[model samples]
Target: MLWVKSLHIIFVVAWFAGLFYLPRIFVNLAMETEAASRQRLLLMARKLFRFMTLLAVPAIVFGLWLFLGYGIGKGPGQGWMHAKLALVLVLIGYHHGCGVLLRKFERGVNTRSHVFYRWFNELPVLVLAAVVILVVVKPF
Candidate 1:
């Protein structure tokens, strides 16, 4: 169980790194007026998205294992885990949203301003803060 938890933390960090950086790529993609830079950023975004998604699967699987196998939140005192899971679900949606944006950027059809993407990039930071607090503080 300890090993599984350790791996879960590793993959979660990996996945969050991708999420954090990918939007910055989008910020560059949205700002780059040169075709060469656009192509390079597009390629980078695609590969990062793929690799991060791979990390996400195992992170989620291990989380589910912790929940089901260890019964971390099934009892009366661990309501924080439920909120943490809800936040994780929201993060998954955010991840999927990034994929949609990635496709839009790939096709050269992205309409959002680089400023918009700069703002968008802050979102995961907030989520990460909330999740870490919920888990570490276990505040309900």
Candidate 2:
């Protein structure tokens, strides 16, 4: 269980790192006027998204193992766990949203501004903060 927890943390951290950077790349992509630079940023976004998705899989798997196998959050007074799970779902949606945005950029159809991506990049930071607080403080 401890090992699983460690792996979960590791993968989650790795995934979040990608989540954090990908949008910044998007910010660059949105602002970049040069074709070569745009292509490079697109390639970076593609690779990062793929790697992040790989990390997310084991992170989710170990998280489920903790929830179901180890019973990390069961029964009464576990509202924090439920909240955390909801936020996790939101994070998943945000991850998918990133992919959607990436595809838009790839298609040369991205209409959003760098400022928009600047704001978009902040979502994961806020989610990560809330999740850490939920896990560590268990604030229900």
Candidate 3:
């Protein structure tokens, strides 16, 4: 169980690294005027998105293992677990949304400005903070 927890933490951190930076890449993509730079950023975004998805799969599996197999938060007084799970789902949606944004960029159809991406980049940080608080503090 401890090993599973450790692995979950590792993969989650790895995934979050991508989540944190992909939008910054979008910020660059939105602002980039040079075709070469745009293509380069697109390549980087594609690779990172794929890698992050790989990391996310294991993280989610390990999380389910802890919750379902180990019963880490199955019983009463576990509202925090539910909250964390909700936020995790939100993160997953955000990850998919990043892919959608990347596709738009690939098609040269991106409409949002760099400023929108700058604000968008803050979402994961806020969600991460909330999740950490829910896990560590469990202040239900």
Estimate every model's Cα lDDT from 0 to 1. 0.93, 0.96, 0.97
Locate the minimum summed-lDDT window of 10 residues in model 3.
69-78
Candidate 2 regions off by >4 Å? none
Over the full model, what C-alpha lDDT does candidate 1 score relative to the true structure? Answer: 0.93
State in Å the error of residue 50, model 1.
Answer: 0.4
Write candidate 1's Cα lDDT for 24-109 as tens digits: 99999988999998899999999999999999999999999988999877888888898899999999999999999999988878
Order the candidates by TM-score, highest first — what do you get?
3, 2, 1
The local lDDT score (0 to 100) that residue 114 gets in candidate 1 is 90
Single out the weakest 10-residue window by summed lDDT for candidate 1. Answer: 71-80
Evaluated at residue 97, the lDDT of candidate 1 is 100
Could you tell which candidate, 1 or 3, scores higher by TM-score?
A: 3
Per-model TM-score, in order, reads: 0.97, 0.99, 0.99
Ranking by lDDT: 3, 2, 1
lDDT for model 3 comes to 0.97
